[model samples]
Target chain A: MSKITSLADLKKKRDELKGGLDIRVKAIDPDSVVQVKVAMATCGIASGAKTVMEFFLEQLERRNIAAIVTQTGCMGYCYAEPTIEVKLPGQDPVVYGFVDLKRADQIIEKYIKTGELVDGIIPVNYQTIDFKE
Target chain B: MSKYSMHLLVCGGTGCHASESDAIVCNLRDELEAKGLMDTVQVILTGCFGFCEKGPIVKVMPDNTFYVQVKPEDAQTIIEEHVIKGRKVTRLLYQDPVSKEMISDSKHMGFFKKQLRIVLRNCGFINPENIDEYIARDGYQALGKVLSEMTPEQVIKEVRDSGQRGRGGGGFPTGLKWEIASKNKADQKYVVCNADEGDPGAFMDRSVLEGDPHSVLEAMAICGYSIGASHGLIYIRAEYPLAIARLKIAIKQARNMVCWAIRFSAQSTVLILNFAMEQEHLYAVKKQH
Candidate 1:
């Protein structure tokens, strides 16, 4: 939990996690932990994704919400700062926009815990073509 | 069918998030619960849908209706009209930037109409964390087929024939690189996925890792198999914490497949701001090629 200053230290930390770690880290089972992805690309950081990420980690830990919070790169939505993607098992993943600390707290409490959708959603302006087999 | 029948997918990509995608999600859930349809409607937050120009995107599954630039205030109407009554939110649908015509389906949309999405195949479609969704989309089938049906040489030949250049800036022939590494007489050769995608305006690698991480895993394993290497490394930057996390999940899922013992090493690469020198070197290399 200390500040990681060096690459060696980061590698060591990652190695420790990888060593003897259960494969359950991947959300294979539906009942497992929810995966929360925060966009931390340079654009996202400029828009305050770092703060949003920290908020999610802290809140999830404080509430014991057994979720995995991580960082991602530019989602090409530079207009929407501090974006986040949440994935629950056995369901689809959703992306939320314009996240501040307050909204982050709400997401954790309502959506992560109770499976309730909150405000701060970007309406779909772009269409994504999904190929299903 | 009455319970959890409707799935609401909200765009949580950075762009839409800045536009209040989170608030929209919260309000939508509140309205659903208030309408006593919480159990019947499952609201999920997903990654980017790739139409960044108009964000705060939302998609209704089974029907695949795209709603664009949705504000928190619009959440109630979306839930009331779309979820409750099963009507498309036409006003929120994406309109062509040029034609200004509301395009409901993504396939006909101009942004993605020309993109060939082999790498981005599973993105915006499946729950990234769910292995089943990935598997259902023939995600691991490529790996399984490569592992069981094709030999290292054959796999290398197929990739070489496919003309898939390294997505990395170098654009080197991927198969040739694998062949070089495979041909080298090293006791420990490595198949490294340059997830260290360091382009300024580029999120191609990041999206692949985030949305369809298994593809990268499959591709990396294929690289490993083709290169006669048992280990793989993803040189990702610490700056991309979400990509790292998703890559971590993907590596874990891939390891469970009972194929080769593929090891994942995630490391941060040095970022170069002005690629003037690199670009010069690239031109020189291209001339030789």
Candidate 2:
């Protein structure tokens, strides 16, 4: 670690460190950003969920998308491994199954970008109590 | 760069530490390891959450679920229910004392909703031990700004306009004091931070030092810049072991980042900090309101 001799150097260092805590910052107001949760249970991992999660994490930042990608346990969709749930700001969370890298890209570009409903969206199976009420 | 998807921040304040928050951290890590979610889910021991009455607190990020009074044994439940399933542990959430309502987010709580944190803003959020975490939250920007952009007069003027008073009772204007010191033409000038909160039940200074030590160091540097001082000293009591330990770590980390390094070749204000403990009884007696 070199000494930050000037204001520019300090600013540069700050920018570099900002990425590390981006997840924590975004967590403050998650309702305003795109939230991606990839199922990483044994079944999901066996079906290449890890790669799909990595793709989302990398591509979202590259595309300058305000998104957070988190890994979760099984969503009870064992048959459709590599499953992901994407929740756009001010919208219901949509779960997609059998997601490869190509499908992940589509989710980012189509569903996440333009809010256009795409293929491979699994219908909400379990009933969740609406906390908003 | 770590690709951690979720972060679990456990409080490591003196108050929370007494309640076995350290064990909670260990148990959470073990649980993550056992579930093979260690890589994705990051468990960090952060400073105080300021809600010590119900501590040890465990806050989940990217979701902002506030879990209060967490025990070491509850770590597995947190990992399984919150981290893995994305289901919040309702029983652990902060319940309103009056309404008996479980509040998931700390922002919504009445205790925090009315308060706007400035000095202790980063207290509960970041890991104080990590220099990068401090930098991420704009830690030494004030010192950088003072050194590069503002003159001593301008810095003094800004402080005056900000209306920040001395925390030590007398409520003296900080900027006036800095200007008075800066006017004195001395070969060597010193900036001293009085961290000796000798009063019983007064833990404000200790909390700041433990939770956000870098902030205090940066403030001292800014003060040194404004007052034409090259040397700095913090007068902290020896009783605050955690604060002292954290201050030592913060100083070392600042040195590694070259925060205390000489800015220019000439007129280098090499701000050196030393801890001083003396006359606790006199200070404590004087501090009594």
Candidate 3:
């Protein structure tokens, strides 16, 4: 409501607004939050990116973890339908293929929460980092 | 913001406000409250959503849905048809100017598809004038991190390792400069931020001070600490009045943070910037990662 008067007051305000702040900050600066991108191209949709994306949205927040889940064009992995990319803060973006709900859960538990790599990783076909994508 | 079943982001930019986005926000919140859905739904009055051609943008979060050209009267239908029934308001959906095809998700729309948000973090997500919104997003965490745990030499080394260059036309290494200043032994050293980019096209500094002012202040404090300077000064242009106002608010907000215990006399002053074309397209990208 006004200028923050003390450290205690600032901490209180931060906690009070943590939920909304997480939703907004995860998007603007996803470095600290888990960044998930669903492949939503025609091929991806045909494979079930829609279900995978929805499952991510409902489950990530339900698990009380902050994440930004958005749809993106094909990452050129057509064979792997319903592919998703997970980028942890300070880490390079990792693409996972054949993502059903079960794999999605494992991703949340092992990769996102525990920082342990999960299975379903697809090797990059080209030099994407050089393109500054 | 947390675990909300739905979030309605209404554009409160100059254009969308003229289109009565305020009424849309009020009505949407009313509809949610009337239906006993306030606990699950959040109505945020955000800045321009970048799609000025389709002003009065209303974005729904968690599902990543976009409703464009919304009216005050569309509130009931949005809540009932879209929010409650899980159906989209087809009439309010954004149509591509070229293809004339409706784009429901912003990620798929060309207007937003090619975009990446790095500098303009909180432009449309939070009320720029509100200090609380700024603090909510870990605004001063960096300053806290630097002062509590880092020595001046340690901070300078980290900056050197990060390879951060100047933000202006000249990409000078920031850490090298700080290391130089810290080595200069003086009773009263100084950290000066030369913010006066008088050129018409240079506006990154101005927009950041306006939208996410606290971040600039935090960085300034960190610089002051790293340079072993007790004083921080900002040289800003006066032509930009909004930047000036927001900088004052940011400075005031930063002063109230828990800096007294960590660092002494870590205060800052301001400057200005300008960029031409599409200045109000600040809210183009939703936090879609």
lDDT of each: 0.66, 0.83, 0.70
For every prediction, compared with the true complex, DockQ reads 0.02, 0.48, 0.13
Per-residue CA lDDT of model 3 for B158-234, tens digit only, reads: 99999999876689999998898888899876567666777776666665655666666677767777775655666
Local accuracy of candidate 2 as per-residue lDDT tens digits, B1-289: 5678789999999999999999999999999989998888888888888999999999998888899999999999998888876788999999999877899999999899988888888888889888789888998888777666667799999999999898877999998999999999998787877888878898878778888989988888778878777767777777777777777788877776744432221112222463111234223322431
Stretches of candidate 2 off by over 4 Å are A40-43, A73-82, A123-133, B259-289
TM-score of chain A of each: 0.70, 0.91, 0.78
Full-model lDDT, candidate 1: 0.66
How should the candidates be ordered by TM-score, best one leading?
Answer: 2, 3, 1
Docking class of 3: incorrect
Model 3 Cα shift for residue B1 (angstroms) = 9.2
After the best TM-score superposition of candidate 3, give how far the Cα of residue B179 lies from its true spot, in angstroms.
2.8
Which pairs clash in the backbone of model 3? A20-B1, B49-B283, B236-B271, B236-B272, B237-B272
Ranking by lDDT: 2, 3, 1
At residue A107, give the lDDT of candidate 3.
96
Off by over 4 Å in 3: A1-17, A22-133, B1-3, B13-24, B30-36, B47-49, B69-77, B127-136, B184-197, B201-203, B234-242, B260-289
TM-score of each: 0.58, 0.87, 0.59
- Model 3 achieves a DockQ score of 0.13
